[model samples]
Target: MIQRIQSLYLTLTGIIGIICGLITDFIPNERIDMILLLVVAILAFISIFCFKNRSAQKNINYLNIIINLLLIGFMVYYLLITPGGDLSPKKGVELIVPVLLIILLAMANKYINKDEKLIKSVDRFR
Candidate 1:
């Protein structure tokens, strides 16, 4: 489980999600964004232990990706509505967190798929 590359990716995704939650104050809607970030983190962590079920793990990663995309959309909407227009320093490290999460989750999913294909090929010899 822990030795898998997808597990490592998921772990990083969880950590990033936690960091995003901690830095949520910079975003316009702190409460909602923080809750979402924490949820994503929890889901990522939970999925790590479900390595026995690659399909379930992949589904969880897909869910996380969707949530992160939603987060990015929320961040963009909030950033655009802020007073100082594009001139303000509203964009912060928090804005990049979701994108990073998505990338990590995608990589994890890729590895998961590769593992699944490999398993399928091996099982065919039985």
Candidate 2:
């Protein structure tokens, strides 16, 4: 599983998610965003081990994408609704993490699909 490119991607995604959650303070005095990001990280970590279950892996990635999307949406909404909330460089940088995670998860899903296709093609020869 560790040898697969998707596994590596998933691992990286999870690590980055965790790091972002721990290091970045996106919202003052609110742990909601941090909690959500950590959840995504944990899901990615667990999905990495489901190499034998392509369907489950794909579904988990889809779910991960949705969570990331929601995270992005929440961030945007918070920024828009809060008074005196400006897109300073520091706060703006925090927004990028979810986008990066979304991209990584999509890439991992693409590779997982490719692997699934390859396995199917090889099995047809039997």
- Alpha-carbon error at 57 in model 1, in Å? 0.6
* lDDT by residue for model 2 (4-107), tens: 99998899889988887887555432477888889999999989999999999999999999999988888888777666635544444567888999999999
The lowest-lDDT stretch of 10 consecutive residues in candidate 1 is 85-94
User: Which pairs of residues have clashing backbones in candidate 1?
Assistant: none
Global CA lDDT computed for model 2: 0.85
lDDT of each: 0.87, 0.85
Candidate 2 residue 13 Cα shift, in angstroms, is 0.9
lDDT of 1 by residue, 29-118 (tens): 788788889989999999999999999999999999999889888888877777765655656556777888899999999999999999
Q: Point out where model 1 deviates above 4 Å.
A: 85-93
Model 2 clash number: 0
Q: What are the C-alpha RMSDs, in order, of all predicted structures? A: 2.1, 2.1
